[model samples]
Target: LEEETEIASWTENGGLFVGTNAERLAEYKRFAETGKYFGIESHVLSPSEVKEVHPLLRIDDIYGGVYSPGDGTIDPTSVCNAYAKASRKFGGGVYENVGVSGIEVEDYLTAGSAPGRRIKAVLTSCGKRIETPTVVNACGAWANEIAAMVGAQIPLKAMKHAMVLTEPIAGMHSGLPNVRDHDLSVYLKTQGDSMAIGGYEQNPEFWPDVDPGFAFGLFELDYDTFGQNLAGHMQRCPVIEETGIKSTVCGPESFTPDHKPLMGPHPGLRGLFHACGFNSMGLMLGGGVGRELTKWILTGSPEVDLFSFDCARFHPESVASSRWVRDRTHESYAKTYAIVFPHDEALAGRGSRKSALYDELKSRGSKEPLDYDLYGACAESGLAFWLVDQGAYEEGAWRLGEADHPDIPKHQSHEYLDLVEGELTFDWPASHATVAEECRAAREGVAIFDQSYFGKFYLSGPEADEAVQYLCGADIEGKRAGSVTYTPLCNSRGGVEADLTVTKLQDSAGSNYYYFAAGGNTATKDLAWIRKVLEDQNFKAQIEDQSEAMTLISVQGPSSRRLLQSLTHSDMSDESLPFSGAKHLEIAGHPLLVLRLTFVGELGFELHTPAESAVEVYRAVQEAGAKLSQLEGIPVRDAGYRAIDSLSAEKNLRHWHADLSNRDTPLEAGIGFTVLSKLKRTGS
Candidate 1:
């Protein structure tokens, strides 16, 4: 683990983020709110001050800069050497020229009869057999191979990254702050008497495999391939073109699918942990990562929510495909310096994990063309889910609409509506069916909507009920089977981690299960959290992520019951299937699990149908509702989420991550009804 850069320097003086365009610079200033919220001292720097900080810059080309005085650079070699010396002084063993060959494990059942894997011993290359109860896979580039030894898959790949050191140039200040121009995709810092330059090129070269012999060795430098970054460096600092190249340093660095590092316990294997895949950010994040990981290792959970860096954030599908991992890793590396706006989907390594209806929906042209550049600024202010400025008419901008009383704009937001002839149409089929018209249809007439993107999951096994009760804020155990309990999955601090709906599907002797549903964006966050809890607590339960396995269609409005009664033989009365009640029945021979719950504050039923029969059931409901609406002389229309949001807002309902986030408690968010104090879920 002894590795280092040649230079030995440490400074807390932050650097400058220079940009040429004023709009881009303003976008960066808005993005810096994240740092400001964290209590970091950051400010927008003027062109003149930028020269005062780093005088070598070409000031005319730069428009503005963001300077953070608390952030700075350090030499990793010095830190590692200091740690190594201190560890050896404390009688810690240091093995050189040796590596772990394989890991041995013993499988056993817990007291709850849940299976567990414990590390038994480790075999090293130096012919050493050591007994150990734990293993930390800190192998940087070879982390995946080490994880494979224990049958654990780590979605990490090695990407070949290169850097160039300049031959000590005149007027080079040894203490000059590091400069990062993300637009140019380049970074520059002082290395001894010379300047070090590196960047993330769009077409980064990644190693297909990580050979043991490749460790601590540089790859053959490809100047032609390096020219892209070289050009960027020249653009950032014209002086770099005058200084002669001293040497090129090219080596393999571990990268994860996301730019964030992997830092938690291995999802599949017990007694094994991963702290690699720094994505070339190891040196900067090492100290903080070490402190947090140490707390996690000792207490079974870290104080902070590391969902972004969790190793299990990725699934087996991602790990099974090396090519996909390579491509995603390359994207992560390349975008290391690129602006990642809200709702910006990665263009690489998609479709590896998709729903059964992915092709059907895609072929039907259900995609919404998102303009990230236009929406990114608003998104930075925690309003990503809200419609951007252009969507003011689609989802009425109440602040502006109420204040100015401007003329109503055309409704152009149809992101969540039913596909018309298998295509998403922003405009209504009929001029009378506007957004306001749809809102009225939902309040008076019956409306059917698509809820296919709901994050669905099923928890099954003997301990299912107890496991959920332990994790939820509401009293789920007291709820009867076939009843839905809306609750929040709280962190240890009793902050809302996720707001979800859970139904006790079965509670009979020797059989127990629960069905859970959350927002689509929380598929990974919620699942990874429950799995981590199950693993740590040795819960005898299995979690099934049915997010894409089932398609959800919702029916709401005053006449929804009558419309559904005409199609299904099941009881539709409030006395039989009351609110929060669930029933398993059939519609048009398609099996369905119906939950009588409403997000739009109305009499609604969410029908969960098998993905294969979703289309059939949807068509049956549509046709039946249409007939009922025509006979009743009321409009029967399909509505989108925008209508639902307006309705929910009118009813004072809370939206997770918007009004209710991990930072707030249920009571604080004015949703104390969703929580039961009997559960004793308050954070002390």
Candidate 2:
């Protein structure tokens, strides 16, 4: 942009991040290592070295710091003007002070004869109608409102952010680098002749109802909230105390639930795209975002892994609730500078969506003993389980053991207090032993897991098989009924778009259908990709989202067959339902589609049943397993996501969004076996 527009909107004064605590310093050291891996220039500085970079900082209390010479600040207003000028030079018209009143949408058929919605036009408040087939909703704080006009939704909310400016100090200059005291959630930079200080507070003020005409508007000085950071600012820069306060700037900034920007095409709409919800980093990420969005608009997909920022990542049900969006957004904003733990889960917006077994799972955490020996053992061991929102559905997590710290208060029903009081560290947690036992059960005896959060979908019609063969990297062609194929769906660049399993099934009428099971969090994203491919190819296939309609229960271990065989009349032999085979059977008097697949590298069966019957079926399985446990003297346990992670990691399994993503190809991910030899030879 700088070269094209010839605008000087950036200041390359470098940046410094200082830590006052050991933990923060350790975090900085790890970040420096990561920067090295990425070939980014960064230096871990000592107190004296940090003083050399910025003499104004009182580094006496600082433990350590990291300095990156490439880090700098951009003037947002100037950058926007430059982009507008560049757009005009490229023959694009720029409009300002115009508000979107409504969006006109119409039903249309794709090239493949599939039903879809397209933008017909956009109506503006200035009595002008723009005739366009695509509309990008880039209205930062008003993004949700604009989306609502088109019957779409994006999970974003605007919150008030404040920054204070001090009268010029004698030694302050433009050359001083931008400095951040992340431990104190405060940042400082030189703004011309003065110093500007800003912070992220624990409790931020939300603007639920932003005025329609509040563009580029500032709110009155929030002294109460802005004052909280003044002490930290003074301690870091002692000269700030002597200088008089110049002015305070407070404005609304849009934030998302996970603190990542909302980008990519809307899943339900054909031509509607999202490029907002930057969480106060718009100025820094704007250029990159603009480039990626442009590429996506022209080519149907972005060039890199953007699933983390995809607007479809959140379940519609969770984002539809204003209360849930507000709570999660608040949590995301507060943790802007907090240390990120690998295993940490959000505490807000719990139970937004739940499986049929949600209540039963919560009951297992109770202190009161039930009829089952498992419950009795849990009570004795002070084991308390908690559920986390996975793909919006409440999935069970590791059970907590007795609190390592006795001073922590205990709840009457469960031990959530332990989670609140226990310090989160990089080392093993108190629940490690409990998770080990669960893993043991899965490896030895028997373990049942409620995996209802898996995203389920169906593709049917005469062209279903053709679509699958084209989209999947595996050789799924000519696969017989009851065959399950684990495949990687790749993009045009051969990057893994999704890692999932596709099972071929036949209806009573002999029509073929395909069942797709994907990671819970990537359900919407995967669906969007499938629909896009189908439409682009003009394939005569119909896609259905059954994620919320079906529930998945997994039974694994060496004794799994014996335990399941005792409950049903269907054949449980390997010859009848071999590995990678799927069949519809009557299990515990309920009809279920069972697949012989294992993510934990064990003999396992995944039973996909109707969501309404999941609780009863799960209870029956638990009861039968308990009876078998008593007879065989082998433990039968209920496992959670943590145990699943441990067992899968033991087998070196790759998890989506963690070990595998859209940025990696199957060959690079060590899963080249899934790709067809023909495609590899042809370099397709």
Candidate 3:
């Protein structure tokens, strides 16, 4: 969606094309030419002004070309070399010029009475043993075989692909762009002094014959015969005929049933990771996939957007036992590069193309979406889109296959998804673009989701700040009356059980403190746990539950100040008053607990107004915030579970259940300081 850049300008760096058209199939009779037509400007050369750029072409004989300023030709060998050098730059262990013989899988992941029953170590052909907690099969092309050794079947196959380079002609300049006749399914790009034009193989079908085992390897090529195929190609770039002869490279291009990459752990095989099946396009997606791979191994989070290419989706068991492996592989050859069919129709008890955009996505690049609602369901919705388009949600996880999974609730206490209402009660991923809309509405004017359940606590006494500092992780010592601090409270055992904001309040009555926590366990457990801890210390603060009288409506986003300013006489800007500050103010002619703070990381306010006036303040924020329509504040970002995973990983924050292994410690997880230093010592 080019929110900030052009999508058409992305690099089409590779030179391999699989499959071909019907007409070209007849001409390349001796050789099996496969793949669809994809002609573009070579490397960096543009395709749009071809005839004008290269006067040697007869416009009629030349097919339309690419004038892409974004496209550039790259030397494949150089890319691999750079990658190898970079890998060594870090402490990564790399082995070269070595061959793997086979692997040994212990039948099960369970340990026996003795010990180490899951996996001992792998014996190499050279009689060396490599023992580790996990093994990543990044061995390209050979991934499927390695997976099979561990009893995990992968849909990986290898198909032969070839590239032809023409001899340099005298008039040929080195600046020609890569050109492809989309109709003919052939592409031509220049490399150094020579022109590297391939995809002349008219067919992309893997099997030369109906059988997969018919033949697999780079067959010999005739230069003169190859030149004949470019008869009309030279008409587009007249300088091409001036070039002499050159060599060609044809080798096996690893492929999968669907041309997409295979990522994530081997489903049935625990502790095994697969990062293979790139086909020819692997290099294009390497960086993102490499990062995701490291994350998955350390955290057990599925590789981002990984479900679509999960190795478990396809079952070799589906193939008839009588079916030859080669035959099965050949039938799926076209599917590798063909538009991908969403990996559905295989989930338990669900196998129908019933979705509206099902067939459409099968033929186009779908839009990815990331969605979340305030209560907590963070879901990324997958929408089927044929071509790229511009929008806030475009090109996000919203349309990825993995984005559809229901965000499994964190707390079993309350059912997240209500089958009765179809309303999710958790912060979900697929609901983000929508929730962000709701958030924007509230920030600008006002809106409310059911904060009917936010956990609330009222603590009051002359020793209020002291009591708060003792029981929670906040330095209430510095917060003057009417100030608030958003703090994350750690459980006595040192886990983040609550994310609450503390507000010091005052009136003619006296100064008191209010602590509102995130919903679900984030609220209820927070107050109950803190109260238990404080009461144990015999603290003098009076703690009471105020959940019944208060309704928490977080009015956040840019229009927050304007919305509140309209209802109350309070000046809300940093210059006028300040922020992370609050006061009881009149809103729509009613007393309200309007705390000028936010959670969506914006210049918004959290109105802890009375429940009776909840809808009023909500309406007020909506009305007043509507008038100040400038996007002055940072947009609230809720990127769902995957995003949270990344953030938590960076913060060295461990989820109580997910990241907490049997022996993991605060020090090992890097949160020891947040615990012993902050909580155990100077804390209650």
Candidate 4:
């Protein structure tokens, strides 16, 4: 950008992140390892070595630090101007001081039975209508407002961020690198002869309402709130204690519920895209974001695996709630500089969404009935089942122990007291043994998992078969109805966009419909991808998102078929409902669509039941498991996600976002069998 635009927008002053404790220092070491894998230049420094790099540090209590020589600061204003100038040079118009008043959309009839909406024009505040087929909502803090005009939403909120500049120091220079004391949540940046100091507060104030004419606006610095960071700044850099304050700058910055930027096409509207909600890292990530977003706009997909930052990651209902957005945004902002443990779960805005069998699962292992008012009580009780966010719903993950475990406290007066803390760690947690037990059950006896969070969808119409064949890498040409094919939805470059199962089912009227089961977190993203493909190809297929209406209960192990047969009147023989086959069965007196498959390398069945009947079906399964346990001496256990991970890992089952991503091809990930033989021969 600097070579082409000739804009001096960046200063290569390097950056340093220092740790104050051993745990944080260990985290730095792990980060350095990751940086090495990515071919990034990074060095782990001791306290004395850190001081050598930056002499201003008070390293007596500091453990260590990590320094990146290539990490530097950029001038946001200059970069923005450079982008505008470069865009104009490329025959792209750069409009400024123009606010979008409304988005014009028209409902168009498609070859399919359902109709779709398309962007027509954009109404501006200047009373001029800009006729365009696409509009990018890169409006920063006001992005949600722009999305609202098109009847779409993004989970973003604006918060007041304040920083202070100290008086010119006697020996400060621009060559000094920026310093970050993450433990203290304070940072120092060189500003000519002075320094700019800022920090992320534990409880930042949210700006729910922003004035329409508040562009480039500043708010009065709240000394009371800013004082929390000011003390840390002085403590980290003692020289700041003697230096006088020059000025305080407070402004509104946008943030998201998960702290990741929202970048993708709008799931609901065609030709509408989102590129905002950077959570204060816009300036740092703008260049890459711009490059990738340009590719996404030109082509139908991006090169990188951006599922983590996809705009459709959040549920529309969750983003629509103002209180949910504020609470989670505050938590996300406060943890900007905190160590991210592998098992860390967000504590805010929970309990709002739950599966149908939430209560049934909670009551099974608890010593006493848990209270609904106690937040995270199940996590600390005798059951020790930790509930985690699975998209919009709370799903149980790991169990520390059973009711009879010695680690659990026997007595408790207050529900919140005697809670087990520090369960979120990078090392082996106390639940390791419990998870191993659950894995044993899945490998030996029967193990049941409440997989209600799995995303379910249906695709049927005149072109349903063609759409599936075109989108999937596997050859589904001759697969009969009721056959399940585990395939990867590949992009044009043969990258694995989504790894899931497609079950072919025929209705009573003899119309073929395909059922899709995907990861809960990637539901919206996968759905949007399918819709985009359908629109681009003009396929007359009707897609329905049944994620909220259906619940999935997985039963796996050597005895899984026997256990399921006891509960249902369906034929248990391989010839009747063979492996990788679907059947409509009556389980526990409730209708269910059962699919025979396994992620844990065992015989398993996935019961797809209505949400309302999930609790009853789960209860019936547990009761049958108890009876089978007495007869066989091999217990049927209730498994959590942790156990699922262990079981799947043993089988080398690839997870969508973790083991496999959009950056990898099915062949490279050791799943070449899922790809078509012709494509492999052609090297496509």
Taking all chains together, each candidate's TM-score versus the true structure is 0.79, 0.91, 0.40, 0.92
TM-score of 3: 0.40
Q: lDDT scores for all predictions?
A: 0.71, 0.79, 0.47, 0.79
- lDDT tens digits, residue span 16-134, model 2: 99999887888898999999998979999999999999999999999989999988878878898999999999999888888889999999776556689888999998999999989
What candidate 3 gets wrong by more than 4 Å, as runs, is: 1-48, 53-66, 109-120, 200-244, 302-304, 315-684
- List where candidate 4 sits over 4 angstroms from the true fold: 366-383, 386-420, 678-684
> What would the TM-score be for candidate 2 when compared with the true structure?
0.91
- Of 1 and 2, the candidate ranking higher by TM-score: 2
What tens-digit string does per-residue lDDT give for candidate 1 at 1-684? 232333344667577789887655866787678887888888788888988888877777889898887778777767777666756766877777887888999997653455667788999998899998778888988888888888878788877888898998677766777888888888887775678888887667767767887767888778876888889888777888888998889988888877888887775566787899998888888878888888768766666656567675565556677766766666667778765543343434434444343344334443311212110101111111222223332222221123223554435434322122112122232222344666787899876666666668888766777788887888776677889989888776677878899988764464768898876545555776676676656777868788667877788888888888988899989998999999999998998899999888888999988988987787788789769867878677666555676788988888875687665778888878777564455542
lDDT of 4 by residue, 357-408 (tens): 7777666743212211111112212124334332112111112111222443
List model 3 lDDT by residue over 342-394, tens digit each.
Answer: 11111111111111222232233323221221111212222221122222122
Residue 211, model 1: lDDT of 86
Clashes of 1: 0
Angstrom error at residue 114, model 1:
5.0
